[model samples]
Target: MSSSSVRGVSATPVESIIEPLRECMVSMGSGHGKETGDRRSPERTVLGRVASIMEVFNGGQQVLSLGDLSDRTGLPKSTLHRLADQLCQVGWLERDPGGYRVGMRLFELGSLAVEGHRLQETAFPYLQALAAKTGMSAQLGILDRTEVVYLERIVVGPVRLPTRRGGRQPAYCTALGKAMAAFDGEAMRAVVSSPMPRRTANTITESFALWTELDQIRKVGIALDRSEAYEELVCVAAPIRDSGRAIGAVSVTGPAGRMRWRMATEAVHSTAAAIWNASFRFGSAGARM
Candidate 1:
């Protein structure tokens, strides 16, 4: 008998046993097998690809070609094409003359996500009150990655401050961002220690000075952005805590000339207290740092 036949004595058919074993070997070599069971599915790959594509829009990039998407997502052209097609079909992405951009479906999903956040729900009433009282734009924002994403806003009349309901602003320069960062411990340090970008002449460009200022914000529970993000705009922010940990911030923003330091400070204190109480009563009551 040949050596292969002699080993297993499978004279019936060599192809049957050998082929199955070869497939099993290949599966095991590629990090798939019974040892890992069927628990590891391809779902994670699909989700990861979708996430990669979504991340390309995080900085508010509105459009991208296949090459741009590939470069941004670090995915191969072929893979990106397949994924993009699926995303477009599902309304997560859309193609226009400019190329692929996030679609209204994603906006709808995001709106739902923001609506679900306990902070948004609990803070709206207080935000409305602040907007009503101060006659300014009141916003509820949270730290998402390195920026502050405004989840909800109550605009008093037609006031504008270079921001929108779903807009994002640098955490180091915005009153809401600073308010959230001050209580975030190491996260706050990392933000201030990182290079501070200059948004305007009044923007804080010094890391050390910003850190010192943040320390004061933590102690006082209020942060002031005096035209740091935009010239002639001022925002007074106060931290909103869940349990004992700060989770988000509420801000009243308007013309800097109208919001004097002392008045802004008082507004921040009163609004923050009301929001904090609402958060405890209606929102994530037990969620701490």
Candidate 2:
């Protein structure tokens, strides 16, 4: 101080102290900058990890243990446990004795998405009527990545079917899938390229055979599933079209021996037509599904 205070002019200026301090601060922060840059390209993000966890349930598995999740996701059990706990907190997952299952929140969100589009609501009555008339389950479905996503199902009797709304079945085997794919060129091509796992003896495993069947369906506006997806189930389906392009398909399903092919096909065809006509009243854009 004594040296700097001579004649009211400081020998050491305040700027000298501040400049070095600033340089030192920047020097210290360079490592933090590098860390920030590293974060920009992480190996895996939290959201991606969560998606990997959720996707394992998409196959309709009721529940999975931590070990099962670890096996399926290849994520460490420690990480999975933490993420699963958080997912359970947010209602995306639920814990069970065995492990965890998809929670009601997912179902609630799915319902909102389906009903928000109004397609499910619009098709419900027609499906109900079809189920009542045929004494079998009536389903509405749309093609999703070479699979048929069941949007709605109206079961008339105690038909112990394995399918459920929001469940997915292969587009190559299910009647609803075939009916929709028969008209949509992109969907047909997707089915052609995907693995056609034979679920039963009647399942179409060959591409040429499936193409022939699709061509026949396009000609008749009807598709049939004769124990192709399930040995006990037989179904008849018709596409709901708008100006020659299919938006969705409707099907009537019953036990193989109990299904009357002639009656089910006629009812499904008319039901699809009626739904297509009704869709215009509900705004055709929503029917795009």
Candidate 3:
């Protein structure tokens, strides 16, 4: 079992995992941290190696041994031992009777993400309303590069989905991702700049077609998943804007056979608008969109 599963750990997005490391690397290596700049010094190499080891401990496989990490990271046992021990001492990694797992330090650090916390808090009541009204699943998601990181989920009935809180799904394929990207120029550019991977047969991998769909989403203020992100699952999402910028999205999801997509869209859009309005009214700085 992945160490995360063994410890019943929640999912963590890749961006969140890398953010702290980026700060640490910038502070330790570069005098100025340019978000776009690439630093390839010896220290960066070490950080890269550390990232490699850390990346291996995901939902699929959470706990690992010195041997397992060495095999996964392609580092020598001696090197792995020294590095893992150092990480353990700093509480970034923990050693167990079975092996090494991600430490609570990561959770503590992740809790400090302001945007995520704000979205979760601001969107929760609306999410609950969406679930109660739609009798499906409602989720809050944020764009993290080419993926949407699920921040909160509300499931009314017993429905199984591949995604969970903090789990990621390709932005190019999900309604939540498309909705967020449609309102953000930078998000649109980043998503279409690269080839979208095929998740399902119905997934839109063509950049041109995706661009067209995004344009429609921008005009309509909603997006359809149409079983793109997962087979047989449909979703309708609307952008949740903060101060006129797309900070995240809210979505309702269900199996295609049972959901009334049109009705769901209305509920999703209304809920998103409610959240957006609430955010402006309650958020710090007193900004509105």
Who wins the TM-score comparison?
3
Local distance difference test scores for all models: 0.70, 0.76, 0.75
lDDT order, best first, reads 2, 3, 1
Off by over 4 Å in 1: 1-116
RMSD of candidate 3 to the truth, in angstroms, is 14.7
Alpha-carbon RMSD of each model: 20.0, 23.0, 14.7
Q: Write the per-residue lDDT of candidate 3 for residues 24-74, one digit (tens) a residue.
A: 654565543334455444233556667767767764677888889888878
Query: Cα RMSD (Å) between model 2 and the true structure?
Result: 23.0
Q: Please identify which of the two predictions, 1 or 3, would achieve the higher TM-score against the true structure.
A: 3
Candidate 1, residue 191: CA error in Å? 0.8
TM-score computed on alpha carbons, candidate 1: 0.60
**Clashes per candidate (backbone, < 3 Å):** 0, 0, 5
Query: What are the runs in model 2 whose C-alpha is more than 4 Å off?
Result: 1-45, 48-116, 284-289
Model 3 steric clash pairs: 2-61, 2-62, 3-62, 3-63, 4-62
Tens-digit lDDT track of model 2 for 15-58: 22333334444444444323455442121455556766776775
